[model samples]
Target: MNPIQQFVRWEAEKPEAIFLQQPLAGVWKKWTYRQAGQEIRSMATALAERGLPPRSRVGILSKNCAHWIMADLAIWMAGHISVPLYPTFTGNTIAQILEHSETKILFVGKLDTWEDQKAGIPTGVACIGFSTYLKTPFPAWEDLVTTHPPLKEFASWTADELATLKYTSGTTGNPKGVMLNFGAFQFVMKEGLNAIDVKPGDNNRLFSYLPLSHVAERSLVEMTALYSASTIYFSESLETFGANLAEAQPTIFLAVPRIWAKFREKILEAMPQPKLDKLLKIPLVNLLVKRAIKKKLGLAKCKWVISGAAPVAPELLRWFQKLDIIIRDTYGMTENLAFSHINLNKVKIGTVGHVWPGIQWRLSEQGELQMKHPGLMMGYYKDEALTNTVLTNDGYLKTGDKGEVDREGFFTITGRIKDQFKTDKGKFVDPTPIEMQLLQNPDIDQACVVGMGIPQPIALINLSAAGKSKSKDAIRDSIAQTLEHVNPSLESYEKLEAAVIMQRDWTVENGMLTPSMKLKRNELEKANLEKYPVWYKMKTAVVWE
Candidate 1:
């Protein structure tokens, strides 16, 4: 069933059960299943009255908020396509997506920085104010809800009906709209619920901090809540994220590697590494240490903790073992509605686990990962050529990722299709395998291997917050030792000459990192390309760049 129908079922099954808890005005606001259904129906009626044709593209731009979810369901309930626009997107990007998708009605919801992003809305496009920050000459959200009653009939969707258009984070090029049908979206929801063992009225609590624009969060937090009647707690802001998480004590916690590293660093900051190491070695004291760590991170009740969007360091996973948390890894993309492999029983640290059921998988002659999605995208909206390059003629979708299956069915992502580089010595190298080794160091938060025209590959390293405070000598020593150990396993072309420690973070605001938490390698290289010469001149194994 579609998410809206699922919501209707949940409302009927348990009307009074808490469906969503949204923190606002320094207070926790709530919505029961029945109340949420009412809001969704009201908004759907309002949109339908606006005379939008069936399958009309409508956009929602905001951070994670209750209105965003309501607006999304309403759009679906109104027989329209919900297009989620990232709040972190530039004005230019917002304009490009809205114009290209033929979206005219944009619902502006709970955004912290609307002033900077509002200019992107084209003159022809209209706006609906759905947030406290949306103070402009626009129709109020409450007006629509109060004036329009619930639509008499909810539009039922078939398997092939267009559901939503997902815009990619554009790591390599312009963001392409990923066209997903109701079949693909519902398939993800059903398979994902099965994978997590979520049943109706299961009491699986979720913390929503990741952007809903991304499919992972949309499914895990929003769609899962509808499918399983799970309660969701929203994070207020960056400053209150910790407190909100602590309040929620989520059952299933999924975090990006960047946030995971930050949590580790913050824990280490309060309790020094030396002290933590010493405390964990003590027999009974280790239990208290683990409890304390989990308590601090609000993961004490986390039955399943997952890391995705990038390769998680094995060292980080091992570090969590001292605290008794086994982080599972997952692999998927927007094109497939983010439904693919999920590490369940057998947790592989470095490898993304077995192929998801019902999804046929194979490797090309070039070792690129390919899968026959049960309900994959029809194609990239308005970009058939681009879609053809990724989706095969035989129903298998080309993942553009290089990987090999193990003796078991598990797959380990080795590198990207365009990730290989040629050295001055004329040998081609894929840095992903080498970078994964370097990232195992607890001191390095992120590592990118780049050296297209240089003699040897240069490792661009971003120090963890804890690593930044350490003396340069110690940091350099740690990396130097790591490199010395890693080079033997790598080919000559893949060996790093030096590690260039970045002084600044690679963030989404700077366009070095995408909203989905994937690194923009090409953008990062261009932004820091000049620093390569400066770092090359430094005759040291590790130098601050």
Candidate 2:
């Protein structure tokens, strides 16, 4: 069944059970299943009354909140396709996506940069803003809900009917909309639950903080919660994320690599790694220390802690494993509904575990991983030519990631085929592995290895919060030590000549990071291409840019 149907079933099964918990002004607000259903139905009626054509594209521009999910449901119930825009998108990007998707109505809610983004909304398109988050000039959601009655005749969707347009975080060019059907959602939800073996129950709790615009959060958190009849808690802001997560104590938790790094830094700040190591060596103290650490991180009750969106360092995973927190690394993309391979019970340290059932995968001559799955997107929206380039004639989705499969079928993504660059010496450098190594150093928060025309590759790095707190000499020494440790393991050409500390952090607002926290390599290169030569020629092992 589709997610809306699942929601309907739960609303009928347990009307009073809390389905969503949203925080505003440090106060927690709740929505029972019945209450949530009423709001969604009212909004659907409002949309239907607008006289839009069937399957019209409706956009949701907001951070993760209860209303974001409700808006998505309302769009579906109104016989419209949901188009989610990243809350971090700039005005230009917002305009591009809205125009490209032909969004009929936009739901503006809970945004920090709405002022900067409002100019992108076309005058012709109508808007409805969440009253709690923003006081927009447009019609308020509360007003619409109060004026419109619950939609008596909800739109029914076939399995193959279009559901949503999930736009990719554009690393190279304009973001392309990935067209997903109701069947894709159903397939992933069923197979994902089966793989994780998490049962549907009221006790299942989920903390939604990640960008629900992304497929990983949409599929795993939003859809999973709907499918399982679980309660979802929303973070109020970045400042309250820790407290909110701790309170929720979700049964299933997922975070990107950057978040995991921040968590590690937080832990190490309280108790230095050296001291923590000494304490953990004690048999009696180890369990207590691990429990305390997990509790502080709000993952004490997590049945499955997953790390995805980008490749995580094995060293980072190993560090967490010391505290008895085993992070399962997963691999997937927007095209596949983020359902491909996941490390479940028996996780290989560096590998994203075996492929899920019903997925067929093979390697191309270029070592690119290709897979055919039921959860694959219908295609990129209104871009059939580009879609044809990725989806093979025989139906396999070209993953664009180069990977290796071990004897046991565990998959390790080596690098993105498109991300490789050639040096002046004509040697190809795969930056992913080198970047992964650099990230192992607690001092470095983000690293990008770049040398398109230089003799040897050099690393551009931003210091972690811990690293920033250290003296310049101390940070340099740490970076020098990391380079010394990582270079010998690489081929001579692949070895980084020097590490250049960035002047500023790479953030989504700056266009250096995707909303998912993956590095925008092309953007980084563009901003620092000319400096590559100067950085490479620096006499010192570490250069502060």
Candidate 3:
């Protein structure tokens, strides 16, 4: 059972099926299955001739494109391990990962701003530019076809051999490489295809906008393309995302919570509460309104839409359901190639859903979620000490998340154990649940709860559009009312003393967030700790500069 055989078999069976749609000369260009497989085979032979040994590290640096997927399959077919880099990563981050993984070859993807990172690639590493047009001076990815002939077959890899190295953005420290074996990648992708009800040549279209380095998009979205022979459409950038969505009319959609929230906001903004409420009062009108919203979002054709990598507000989930879009919340990590369990048949609004088949999980006595699965990483690359610490003697991988299982066996992630802090009163408070509640208020765009040595947890919020545009009196009254509504559900010490509304949004480059979109709690807490008194004793809403 070789994974690369999926490509070979499909190419032989459906040689003319469109496998990729990429932007070229301001138009979408199609690549058939045979064309893609032939390119991959040629590139594999070229990589072998260049002396990339079995399991040798090969890094890919590009936005989501057909070439990116082709390069990955080629590397795996050559019996080399792939190392994917995020398009948003800084040069230093790229350099650190390259050095850590000992990457021998770098495939430079197209980048508008982060292209300068190429300078940081070590002098000895061979480099090639991945582009559809072969414009770069360096060896173009397309030129590999001419440089070497297609091999009779791609190198066969066993189930136990290494396939890829995913360097996930760390929440606590520098990123560590999560080593995924061929067996793990194959099993996870197979399970995902079954879970999503994918079928061969089913008009399954994926809008490949999310970073390919992320497991949620890579395995669940791109890997499915290998089996179903689906056509993948790559978004050029954020500016063209809307147009791309309209053009693609994708059958499957996957997005983070932030993008989903933005789509929700756009619809609600177009129709205010009074008009929407009146529309909902009528039966057929309400149905039409829901269908219209779904059609406008270009999700009317989408059979399944998934959200993961962060918690989504339950209210937002319900809002989408009203529009006839079933939003499935999933939970997984790079260590597992992102397919652990998904909420498909059972739709639990707030929970992450039950563990999928072929994976076993148990919560530690301290409440940390631990799991051992065939899909679990071999270990962190070059970090044996840290790897040993996380992998127990029995081989179950310890996920840092603190979670709870219901009697029905569904899992709910409360917070990260490292993010949990004890208050000055010695009561432990988990911020994730509190923050989720705060975000539900509809007046807070982002919220983080923190207080290391304070009497109680303090909330720092970035105001929603309603809060920002309204008068101070109206906004404060709403927040006060919201706090009153959210407080009674919490324990005595878990209740917030007061809250501060911040003016600026927390972003990745500003040191406020990790690459995976998790808040840098330590950075946030320390930066605003000095202003605690001002926010804690507040009788009225105070806005920060």
Best by TM-score: 2
Q: Evaluated with lDDT, which candidate comes out highest? A: 2
Candidate 2 wrongly placed segments (more than 4 Å): none
Q: Of the pair 1 and 2, which is ahead by lDDT?
A: 2
- lDDT comparing candidate 2 with the true structure: 0.91
lDDT per residue for candidate 1 within 1-545, as digits (tens), equals: 77778888888889999988988766989999888888889888888888877889999998888888888888988989989999999999999999999996999877766788889999978788874546767887777788888775888999888888999898898899999888887887777678777788669999999999997888678887888888989988899999899988999888988888888888987998899999999999999989988987999999989887788888888888778988888888888777778788798777889877678888899999888865688899998998898888898888889997888778899999798878778888898888889988888888899887677888998888777778999998999999899988887777888998887888898889999888899998788777676676676788776
Residues 1-545 of candidate 2: C-alpha lDDT, one tens digit per residue: 99989999998998998899998888889999999999999999999999999999999999999999999999999899999999999888989999999998999999999899999998688999998888988898989998999997889999998899999997888899999999999998888888777676637888899999999999889998899989889999999999888888898899998899989888888999789989999998999999998998899999889888988888899999988888999988999999889887698988999898889999999899999988999999898999999999999999999989999989988999999999999999999988988888888888999988799999999998999999999998999999999999999999889999999999998989999998888899889999999988876799989
Please give the TM-score that candidate 3 achieves against the real structure.
Answer: 0.95
lDDT of each: 0.85, 0.91, 0.82
Relative to the true structure, candidate 1 has a C-alpha RMSD (angstroms) of: 1.5
How do the candidates rank by lDDT, highest first? 2, 1, 3
Prediction 2 TM-score vs. true: 0.98
Write model 3 residue lDDT over 375-415, tens digit each, in one string: 88899888899899999999988888898888877788999
Mark the regions of model 1 whose C-alpha exceeds 4 Å error after superposition. 530-534
